[model samples]
Target: MEKFTTLTGVAAPLPIVNVDTDMIIPKQFLKTIKRTGLGTSLFYEQRYHEDGSENPDFVLNQPAYRDAKILVAGDNFGCGSSREHAPWALKDFGITCVISTSFADIFYNNCFKNGILPIIVSAEELEKLLDDASRGANATLTVDLERQEIKGPDGGTIRFDIDPFRKHCLINGLDDIGLTMQKAEAIAGFEGRMGEARPWV
Candidate 1:
């Protein structure tokens, strides 16, 4: 996982609610365990038509949002199955931050593990962010994790809260594997002691 101290980029508005895992990456794209290549398939159904052509109507496919790094979505985002691929797809698509009024617990947790910031704000706050995102190519927002603040295009700021531990993990680029590696010396010492005491076994 990459460290996420601060990010500044365009925010695309996705005002739909109840966006589930399947709607994000679709079941057909789930066979691969690798994280790469999913970006093209993110929101596959909504981004493509029956003939596999790009859907011009989807927010992601629009000219201004094709490279959006943040997403401002409606309430109840990521509300279905606990598929970890949803966050994978989002991160792969260059969206490292997601701002919504609320999110599903599983999806929210998955975002942090994958180096994505999932922000929860009041409904009123979301409306403000959404309004900023509606500005096409000018929907830039800056997310500063250290300050727990989001700076909008018009110089407005919104403060958010996050667990201190999760903030540390993201700041240091520490995933579960990375966290375990931090204890490598201790783990090695314990294994060496166990081996000496149980040589017969």
Candidate 2:
């Protein structure tokens, strides 16, 4: 996991709602547990045709959004299965932040665990962000986690809220394992004490 403090990059507009995990990476791409290579397979079905050619009509296939780091999507984003690979694919694809009106609970948590910031804003605010993203190559938005604000292209700012613990973890690049490791010394001490107390076992 990487620390997510502030990110300023092109925002890709994905107005379609109910984007599920399968649509993100597809089941065929889930054979490998490794995260790095999944980026190319992100949104595989919609991004490619049956003959393996790129779909020019897809938003991600467009040249301007090919390297987008932020996604401004419609409501109910990440609404299906609770696969961790979904966030892995998004992060691998260089999407550091996702802004939407609403997101599925499991997918939202998975995003944070994988170092991706999933932001929820009002419908009105999302429309504005989508408008900014419509500018194609010029759709650049700045996401400042510490300030909990998103700065749009024209300098307008939208505020968002996040849980304090999740915010701290992202700032410090701490995942679940990282959180547990924070008490390494105590864990070691406990093991040592247990061994001394129960030598026969």
- TM-scores for every candidate against the unseen true structure: 0.98, 0.98
Per-residue C-alpha lDDT of model 2 across residues 45-66, encoded as one tens digit per residue: 9999999999999999999999
State the weakest 10-residue window (summed lDDT) of model 1: 192-201
lDDT tens per residue, model 1, 1-201: 899999999999999999888999899988999999899999999999999999999999999999999999989899999999999999999999999999999999999999999999999999999999999999999999999999999999999999999999999999999999999999999989989999776
Off by over 4 Å in 2: none
Model 2: which ten-residue window has the lowest total lDDT?
A: 28-37
